[model samples]
Target: MNRKDQSLAALVAVIWGFNFVVIDWGMGDVPPLLFLAARFLAVIVPAVFLLDPPPVPWRTVAAVGVFMSLGQFGFLYVAMDAGMPPGLAGLVLQAQVGLTILLATVVLRERPTGPQMVGVALGAAGLVVVGFGRGGHVPLIALVLCLMGALMWAIGNVISRASGATGGLALTVWSALVVPIPLILLSMILDGPGALADGVAAFGWKAAVSTLYTAGLASLVGYGIFNGLLSRNTSASVVPWIMLVPPVAIGSAWLLLNEVPSTGELVGGAILVFGVLVASRTNRIRREPARQAANSVGEPNLSDPTPCTPDLPLPGTPAQPAPAVP
Candidate 1:
């Protein structure tokens, strides 16, 4: 990636990192499901009318929408509202990466690399530590919900991969259309009409600004730039930059929300992050033979040829995987 694109990718990371704080600010008196519905409504409107639907089958779109958009954010919003701090939410949500790997192993029958196994173990251990550290600061149910959200994200990642769609933005925009009604209905049913109405009446500038940042900047702009870079560069180059997100989330939470990580959270989060990094490291040695074979035949040898695994978007954003083309 060129410096310009790299900078753009970094910017996206920052936007996504700070997104947890934005969501917290936006919640105010709004019901979690209702707020999520509004956010997705913002994402789909105007843009959906202008953009063509994604080329993938409607079933794929619907599946991705349900799991990625509704399931992921539904659980996350509820978790946060239930008292999971934004900083820890940001870090814990990344367990989706490891979860995806495990799911792929079971469903797709892919063998895990040693590093990946170790990473998954380390990440799980970290979560256990985080769980033990919860005490009264964080709710166990909230942490469980966040982990469930990560699992939903992993399911969505699998769906996106199976769809074989290259147009991340199109998929994202179109899939968003599936979210609002169900969420609103759920809000009405679960939160009750009275609560929903009161929350909407109480919605203020903070809610509006938070929705704009989440729907406009984080979902649309962030995914736009990140997917654009994926089209022009290797996923290996682009994906690692996502590791920057947690630090930014941690720092932003401390500064903006005045939230501090407990010692357990800090230690566990570090172990988890390090485990994910170890797990994600590609086996260059194993790929050298393939590279040599391609070179001998005069075919172009990509420095990083692994299939791009899409990262789960922050709450309110759809997951956008890069094209599998080498």
Candidate 2:
């Protein structure tokens, strides 16, 4: 990756890292489900009307929306509300990378490479450490919910891969259309209509600002730049930058939320990050030919239509795993 694209990746990481604190602040008076609905509302609205839909089938779009948007955030927001700290939330949610690899192995019959296997094992160990360390600081139910969110994120990745949808912005906007109604309906059932109304009435400047950051900067601009880089470079080159997100998240949480991790959580998080680095690492041989060819021709090889799908985060910036989400 060039310096410019590297900077863009770093920017996305910063925006997404701080996003947890923003969400926590934003959800102050608002219920999690209602807040999530509002966040997606910001994502869809007039923007969808202006942008063209992604070329994927409607069913694929709906599937992405269900797992990526609704399922991920529904579980995530509730987990955070149940007292999972924002910084830890960012780190723990990265388990989606391992989950994605495991799922692909089973559902898609994609065997894990040696490095991927090691990465998965290390990541699982880290999660176990984090889980044991939680004790009373974070609820077990909240931890479980976060893991469920990560699993949902992994499912969305498979859907995206199966659909072969590379249209990032279009996919994000159109798929988001499937989110709000279901989330609102669920909020009505679970949180009660009274809570929904109260949340709307209590939607203050803090919440509005948070929504704008998540929907505008983190989701739209972050993913936009990320996908653009993926289009220009190899996935191997682009993916490693994502490893920066958790550190940024941890730092931002420390600065803003004053939340400190336990020694066990810290050790677990480090191990998990290392595992992800190992897992996502790819041999350069396959991409070398394309790169060399592009360099020789002084142009990009557009013939290979590899989708620029990095599962970071979309609208709500729910802690996406690897390849893509938000």
Candidate 3:
């Protein structure tokens, strides 16, 4: 990535990092699923009217929504609501890089390079360390939920990669169409009508601002700039930049929310993120030949497709994960 693109990627990391705090702040008294439903509903409007869904089947879009938007954020919001600190949440979610790769190996039949395998192993070890240490700081259930959220995000990543949809706002907004209704209905069941009513009544400026950031700035603007970068660069260059997000999230949370990570978490997160950074280094021998072959025939470089999703572009981004939800 060039300096300008580097700046933009860093900006995305900052936006997404602080987003965990924003999401937590906004859900003050609201149920997690309801808050999530509102955010996704906000994500799709006006923009959805402005463009058509990505040129993919409705089922494909729907599946992406279920896993990416609904499942990922569903578990994420609930986990945060359950007591997962924003900084740790960001760090733990980096597990998506390894999850996406393993999933792709099984589902997409995409073989990972040796470095990627080593990186995934290291990431798994880091998760184990975090798991053993999390009981003191974060709720055990919350940690598990957050990991589930990462797993869902990875599945969505694989689905999008398989579809080969050039990601953009259309895909984000359209796939998001499947998010709100399910969440809202589930929120009703879980939170109850009285609590739901109270949540709606409590919706205020803080929640609105958070929603705007998550839906508008983080989801739309962040994903758009990220897609533009991926279009211009390889996943090897782009995914590593996103690895900075955990530190940004941790720093922002410490400064803003007074949420400090434990020593164990810090060490484990460092290991996990380092593994992801290492994994981001691509196998040029495998990719360059394919890219050259495609270019020689006037074909698009299939190795790097602009993944259009609110949470992830891990198709090739996996093959290390980047561009997933905040």
Residue 42 displacement in candidate 2 (angstroms): 0.7
RMSD of 2: 11.5
For residue 147, what is the lDDT in candidate 1? Answer: 88
Ranking by TM-score: 3, 2, 1
Candidate with better TM-score, 2 vs 3 = 3
**Model 1, range 1-326, lDDT digits (tens) per residue?**
55676678668878988999899888899999999888999899889988888787999888878887889999999999999878778767877756665565455434455665675677677766754554466788998999899889778766665565677777777888889999999999999999999999988999999999889987778755654554454333444445456666876987887777678867766775676467556432122344445445533447868655534579998855432223
TM-score of each: 0.74, 0.74, 0.76
The candidate that wins on TM-score is: 3
Identify the runs in model 1 with alpha carbons over 4 angstroms from their true place. Answer: 1-13, 109-112, 115-135, 223-244, 262-326
Candidate 3 clash pair list? 167-308, 168-308, 311-323, 311-324, 311-325, 314-318
Per-residue C-alpha lDDT of model 3 across residues 161-220, encoded as one tens digit per residue? 666666556777888888888898898898898988999998999999999989998878
lDDT of 1 at 318: 82
Task: Point out where model 3 deviates above 4 Å.
Answer: 1-11, 122-137, 224-243, 262-273, 283-326
In model 1, state the lDDT of residue 160.
68
User: What pairs collide in candidate 1?
Assistant: none
Give the CA lDDT, 0 to 100, for residue 52 in model 2: 89
Model 2 misplaced stretches (Cα beyond 4 Å): 1-13, 124-135, 222-244, 262-273, 283-326
